[model samples]
Target: MTTDRQISDQRVALVTGGTSGIGLAIAQRLRDDGLRVAVLDLDREEARAVANDAAFLFVGADLSRRADCRAAVDAVTGAFGRLDVLVNNAGFQHIDPIVDFPEDTWDAMLHVMLTAPFLLSKYAWAHLAASGQGRIVNVASIHAQVASPFKSAYISAKHGLIGLTRTQALEGADAGLTANAICPAYVRTPLVTRQIADQARTRGISEADVEQQVMLEPAAIKRLLDPVDVAALASYVVSPAAWGMTGAVLDLDLGWTAR
Candidate 1:
């Protein structure tokens, strides 16, 4: 356990999408782990509320915009003075076949899920390297590895995120920085909850059927994963104990890929 004095000198971490779901859980867990935590989200009021409740530094930025991404990083560094860890956990879902998928939706999804991480990583590179044990954890999904129908944008963004993770890992190696991605199966979050309905409509099934037949059908474990499940793994990934774990794509898939 880190002593109080040590925690006073603790590193700072930034979590994107930290207003809710897996991102929120990871931010809380990192705070519990003695790090100074900053949360970046699109909703300013919600971000402020959560930050106040958790005693965290919060910034709101629509990650789909390049200027917003840059400003978010600047806000974190300005508030915390340095950034030691980054968790790219902001994303959303859109259920539609490729033909029906909106072009604007595709562009927005890529911008937020894929391009935002790239830009944030680019901007935070120097401060992270200065930390001397910098860590970057990309909250990818099992969709990054295997694809289901009607999720082209999400799957594409996640797959690209893994590629970004690898590149960051390689570039950060000499600087004592590390980057890794956690590929989880369906997690219980507002995002996934909303997906249940969208998926049901998309597949012409009832909402109840969507969870069992569609979401968990591929999983060996027939249960939705709590946000804390991902948070716990994230805590480990960003810790000093995981220094050798760069360039890795970790699976929290509940055996979905085993088949």
Candidate 2:
């Protein structure tokens, strides 16, 4: 029931940090949507351990390294022969007061959260352009639009990512490629679970209080976000119906930004 043209028109998606958590959820969702999914992460074994068998490829590459970013893109295009969607979802967070924030930590956060997306976008541009329906979705944070104490580097890098997303949108418009960002708040992921503990210790609060009084304090909804929720949103955003929705910064913040 398929022709060669239809086969060549098949969509392929590459998700960074796709080994687990939000990244994995997105990859699985895209795969279920009938797209060839490629997961780029740091460890091949870890990637395989959590990767869906339906996924098209698992590439081991550190996003924080520019060479690795290029290589990951190359590997995906090599394996799939084309790239249609890019989910820039690889990231980690470090929480610390500005005065105590380590310079190296800041640099590392920027490298992974901000610079990596740019590098990946750069390398994937040509292939994405050729797809005629290329989609670039950056997983930014609520901090991209707001400030929180003890998260100087995280907030800064997220803000920069938003800027990059907007610029990509402008540049990719002529090429049928679209760029957008999803800004989530307090998602229940390994990175956020670790932050819950770190923030508790730093603020001298119980972990429960940290989640209640601090993490969900600004939101209308008081619960942490589910990875599947974000993944669902990602699916919609990258679909053909969302072609008109480029350059938008969508908030999955449980009304945190509404306040």
Candidate topping TM-score: 1
Clashing residue pairs in candidate 1, if any? none
Ten residues in a row with the worst lDDT in model 1?
1-10
Off by over 4 Å in 2: 1-7, 52-56, 197-206
The positional error of residue 5 in candidate 2, measured at the CA in angstroms, is 5.9
> Considering only N, C-alpha and C atoms within 3 Å, which residue pairs clash in candidate 2?
none
| Sequence-dependent TM-score of model 1 | 0.94
Q: RMSD of each candidate?
A: 2.3, 2.0
lDDT of 1 by residue, 1-259 (tens): 7676775478999999997999999999999998999999876676789888999888889999999999999998887678999999999988789999999999999999999999999999999999889999999999999999999999999999999999999999999999999999999898788879887988999987998898899999988899999999999999999999899999999999999
The lDDT of each candidate is 0.93, 0.89
